[model samples]
Target: MERLNAFDIRELERLCPGGVKENVSLAAISRWQIGGTADVIVEPSSVAELCSLRAFIAQEGLPSVVIGDTSNLLFSDEGLRAVCIRLGSRMSSVHIENDIVHAQAGVWVPFLARKIMSAGLTGAEHTCGIPGTLGGLICMNGGSQRKGVGSSVVTVESVDTAGNICHRSVEQCEFSYRSSVYQNNSEVIASAKLSFLSGDKLKIRQEMLSILAERNRKFPRKLPNCGSVFKSNPAMYEKAGPPGAIIESLGFKGACCGGAQVSPHHANFIVNTGVARARDVLTLVSKISRCVLESVGHHIEPEFKFVSVHGEIMPVDEMLKGFFYE
Candidate 1:
């Protein structure tokens, strides 16, 4: 990691007002609460500030990473050696204009869903229970198998690697199952305009409540977890069923490795039993993959977003290289 000189720090303070925090604990910023410190952390209050920070990182040739709410992510015990920018409460705003909702990327998706429902908006009710920021959800194409955030996205506003703002229509977003144009890009979403249908406010509220209730029953969030570990393979999903059922069929539910355990309530989830380390989770996931391959003869692919060992946030595909199981 390139060390931020005194001038860089001063400039950051000048732009953000809030001084840069050095050696910040990544664990404190994540949902799993189990990572080490990052070399540098910056809180950018708004999209303009984020753009400025991104440009500074580029000019200084420093590795930088953007995180939102940290729900679907898990950092390593080794921590991050790069600049980390978190869009704090300052950027979380929402506005309604006729049938469209304009929301900052930092807005909490579930909370935004409720606000939209209160405004008599439909089509995003399924997001009421999704615990991720709007940017994170849009980046991951987050939602149920049948419905997703992509359907409601009318336009996306993002900053490129050069810190230049660009807006793209829904047609240019390249949204697919669990992915979008930004999936592997060095860009950050600033805000998005989502189109919604007018609906009965009371009916929308009830639908959101029901969705939340169903998610609570099926996802088992009483303990810490990164949602499902794998996306159900299409062939198996149509034939044998989802990854959870395939895992349960092997009687691997309630399986444990140190403090990490496969959730008894949901076979696909590896929940923190109490104090699971990043290593423990990786160990259990590797064991599950091996067992499934040996018994079911189908290589189940994992759906992890972040799991780093070198103190850098890389794609899960590259980060899993050193592990015994691919």
Candidate 2:
């Protein structure tokens, strides 16, 4: 708290007004309902305000993070000491021009899917069941194997740390398997232009409904959880089917650590059974990775991220040994 005052967080409030918040609980923002309080949270209601806030953070050399729907993220028990920027409803909008659908960063992927369905767009049906923001979906290349969200992207609009806006073509988006240029974490995704094919409205709606049903069957929705615990690499799947197959083969489905439990419905999902802490999930992930590696000679990488004890956002594989609490 003292550190916040020293950094003059009030100055940010002066700039953003009704947008800057202090001592925010991360649990409230994330899907898993985990983590402690953040030092500051900024919700930029518009793109201009978002750019201003990003500029401020950059000029101050302050630690900061941006959040979307937070379906794929987990925060540490220590919480975030950095300023966290969030895109609110005001920033979310979906517009269709012919066969192109334009959406802001804050638009939910599922919502976008529905909007596309209404517009008779076919390319984004696979995104209907993926829980994330348009920004996060593009950043993580999030979507199903049959049709990832990356393919629909035609152009990307972004704000850099210097507060300069830039646009990138689909080729420059550098989309690959579960990865994209946005992974650099150096830009704030503002909006994206998605090109799609025309389809029968009824067909698009039916496909979206089918995908949602399949997702509901696979995901443990009753429990609090990040979508998938580990990224299912091609080689891993080639040798062991889906990531869930590997976990099931290793006899780890339904495994529990403290209040965190691996979903019996999906081995790739780790859910909070109640009273689960960041440490519990971290420990479980480490143990599972080690077990999978030893048993199959293949390293399983975590898909979800955790706020490290160092107060940095990091994947499970990158954390320093002994840096996490047992």
For TM-score, the strongest prediction is 2
RMSD of each: 2.1, 1.9
Superposition TM-score, candidate 2 onto the true structure: 0.94
Candidate 1 lDDT tens digits, 73-164? 77888888777777646678999998999999989888899889988988998888878899989988888737879999999999887778
Predicted candidate 2 versus true structure: per-residue lDDT over 240-320, tens digit per residue: 777788888889899898989889888989999888888888888888888888888788888876664334666667863
What local lDDT does model 2 show for residue 281?
86
lDDT of each: 0.80, 0.81
* Candidate 1, residue 260: how far the Cα is off, in Å: 1.5
lDDT of 2 at 223: 87
Q: How far is candidate 1 from the true structure (C-alpha RMSD, Å)?
A: 2.1
The alpha-carbon deviation from the true structure for residue 24 of candidate 2, after best TM-score superposition, in angstroms, is: 1.4
| Residue pairs whose backbone atoms clash in candidate 2 | none
Q: Itemize residue pairs with steric clashes in candidate 1.
A: none
